[model samples]
Target chain A: MHVPTPHTPLPRRPFDRSSFVLSATLAILAVLTIYGFTTFDTNGVDMDMALDMLGDNAKTLFFAPGLSNVTIEGLLKNLGVTVALGFLTTVLGAVIGMVFALASALNLAPVWLSVVVKAFTAVVRAIPTVLWVLIFAVSAGLGSVAAVLGMTFHSAGYLIKAYAESFEEVDAGSIEALKASGADWWQVVGQVFIPSSRAALMSWTFLRFEINFSTAIAMGAAAGAGGIGFDMFMASGFYLNLREMGAFTYAILIFAVLLEYVATKLHTKTMQG
Target chain B: MTILHVDNVRKTYGGNSYALDGVSFSVEKGEFVAIIGPSGAGKSTLLRCVNRLIFVTSGEVSVNGIAVTGLSNPSLRRLRRTIGMIFQHYNLVNRLTVLENVLHGRLGYKSTIAGTCGFYTASEKNRAYEILHAVGLHEHIYKRCDQLSGGQKQRVGIARALIQDPTLMLCDEPIASLDPSAAKIVMDTLRDINTRLGITVVANLHQVHVARDYATRIIGVNNGRVIYDGLPKDLTIDIIQKIYGSEAHDLILADGDTHGTH
Candidate 1:
């Protein structure tokens, strides 16, 4: 028996250094340009006035003995209202958004229906959440309902797009098998598409809830709903109390942490199963 | 006793090459026929056309003497209920239980409201159980589909087709994905069903020995057309060489060998 010798390796090409140098130089120049534009100062008088107000508010808060108790109570009440608004708006948005998403998914609906739904979602998302809140406040009057509707509209737009993408990612083979087995169109959607993507849909819904929570806070301030943002505005204008403002700010932070924890738990549990 | 008739069936995709080129054949009731051919030789397209899964470009397919090509969507769906199809991948809903997947075969018979509510009648449930038992999967009915082995999953697929109680069964490479032992089991099960229930069966298969073992009639396809149709014993080496051309020797196996070990 004869043994064969291994072949020698071919020469490797040298690395090109010019592309890296050019990319790094361009990135640094872009950063410098953005920094120079943003730092250009035109509001010196406005800055001075804001500093004066903050100093006065701090002085008052330091002198007040009962400030801590009042701030705590206010923070709790504001947090409760914010959570309630977020929950209500998210539920409404999810129901309507799921319908639109299903209608738009290519695997589920006709071509014309999918196109119409995509256009509708695009238009809805184009309007800012703050603008919706302002419009509702002006037309429907200042209240929690206006704030909730504004948040729901924006959330529905975002969720419809996300849910539709998720629905499209479902296995095409399962759907084809269902259709070939004499299943009706609706049957194919319910049994095949829904079950395959249930975990992904749940994760997307939880993610939307976190976004909607923050949106509710901002919309509440714009629409005069009784939430933490409203308390922050009132404390700034009427009492000028630094402790109250700090407490409300801290409350927003706490809410964000709680929502993050819940979302993480949900994602982990779903993946485990 | 003719159960299915295909008259000049032709299927052309993208207006260029034909998947099936003007092929015509009839299946008698209770007969077990196997379509053996090379890959992309129109075996699957011909099988799909029988159930109207893929629309025939220029032909008519009649099931139980009723014309299926000209039927509307609703009528076509109704016609499909009488025909059962099996796939190479098994195609069971992975997230659903084996029993529920089998029960899906009754979607054509169930009302829209009933299907939406996830309700199946008592007799239908019993029939599903009976079919599962017949396929030797009764003990695994409540298990999720992904939990089963390859052979077991294919058995569940067969059970699902059986629950339809179809007049004709169309199987597209039903045993191509299994090991030798498992493939033998599935083939034997199909043969047993054909003998007992007397339901007409048309299967697409790649193995010549498998076709000879289970099928009474064998049809050879090459380049989108049927080149041979006769008894299994009459399919000599010369005809095999013509059908497969360059790789004809690979198609031959020992006669009456079921386990694929010979």
Candidate 2:
């Protein structure tokens, strides 16, 4: 069973330059980010206070006695609101992102326009999602409307990059065949690009939906948007109801896992067919 | 009647060298013409110019006496609708069904909305099914195209091109990617399609024997210029050597079917 085959051995995998550069850049970025975070202190806390807080949090996390006070109906309503926000933002982002993605695809759009859109999306992606929500709160006031618009804006930026990359990765031969068929620009996009990239678009949309779900929760907590996150924020920050936070956390984790399972199944099915 | 005419066509890529230099040819209705050449000999460049897939740097190309060069976008699209082009790799949308891929052939004729929604008419669907059957792929009609084998994929490519009801069909190395047996089947299908439809055909071919067997006439190209143009029977061994240079022996004799397999 342990005998070696009398054939040439497989070539050793090389640590390629691009991977090396990637890891090196990531290492540097991580160090710098840690240092930057260190500069913004949350007012120094002694080790004793940290230990006490950790003990209290751990007990609440393990036992979750506040589960008795948590009404299933109230919890379900807030969870539904959070899920709706995530769904709405993802759908709207995909719609708007698709239009911009087409214009941002290198081969499809003119150079100047594509460059401008690409630059704009990069900036949008660079900003944190919570910061975007807070910025919008200043104008639209702290509410669910601001949360929806903020999440949609940031989600559009994320989906734009994903959709554009998907479109660009489409096989050149398929595009060439359509172009030579004398199909107009719109026809080519409608018939060729969209169909060829359908699976990729779906996969990207699913990934963005996961991201938006987390961001929607953050928006609800940070910007006073109405969702389970707002209630959890109150329980943790104002009332210090650790047990309620634990329950909400468990619910969020279960929903996330369910969504992920569904996405993976759909992705595999689409890839195979 | 003449269906295509190219006069002194030259395509340059911002340099002194030309991809196609002074290429001139004319095709009458129902002629099966094959352009044979070595790699990088500009055979593809020449074929692309006839359909205006790539514009020529200088000179003229006309189809049915209409100037293909310098035509407006709409005019060019209208011109292209009448001509069908197939590829070596069988460029089908793999995610689409076999019928849907074939229906794409009519995209040039349909409005953007119709093409987008895939509103193939009843007659068009019937015609596509018939074409699929003709290509011996009727059972695979509903299957996604990626499920097919290489030869079967190319058959779908042929059916797609045929659905356009094209007057002129241009094939760029259609059999290059296929295996020996698959190559023979594809070549036979192309030959049958040519004879049955009486459509004028222009094909780019790499294999000498395949072109000689399938093409009524062959044009040899080298260094972006035509070196020989005559009936396939008139193509001498010496001429083949001249066209392919040092690579002729390995390419033709090694295939062991220089006299045409089928």
TM-score of each: 0.86, 0.90
Please compute the TM-score of chain B alone for each predicted structure, in the order given.
Answer: 0.95, 0.95
Docking class of 2: medium
Q: TM-score (chain A) of candidate 2? A: 0.81
Candidate 2 Cα misplacement greater than 4 A, ranges: A1-53, A65-70, B255-262
Model 1 pairs whose backbones collide:
none
Cα lDDT tens digits for candidate 1, B1-262: 8899989888998868999888888889989999988888899889888888788999898999989888887777777878888888888888888998998888877777676555888898899999998899989989989999999998888887778878888889988888888898998889988999888899998888888878999999988888899999999988887777775665554334432322
Put down candidate 2 lDDT per residue, B1-262, tens digits, no spaces: 9999989999999979999889888888988999998889999989888887788999999999999887998888888888888998899998899999999888889898888777889999999999999999999999999899999999999898888888898999998887789888988888887899888899999888888889999999998898998999999889999998987887667544633312
- Candidate 2 lDDT over A136-164, as tens digits, reads 88899888888888899999999999999
lDDT for each residue of candidate 1 in A119-211, tens digit (9 for 90 to 100)? 988988999877777777787788886787788888888889988998898877667666776788878777877777777888888887887
Native contacts matched by each model: 0.38, 0.64
Q: After superposition, how far is residue A186 of candidate 2 from its true place, in Å?
A: 2.3
Chain A: TM-score in each model: 0.78, 0.81
Badly placed stretches (over 4 Å) of model 1 are A1-26, A29-74, A135-138, A141-143, B247-249, B253-262
Identify the candidate with maximal lDDT. 2
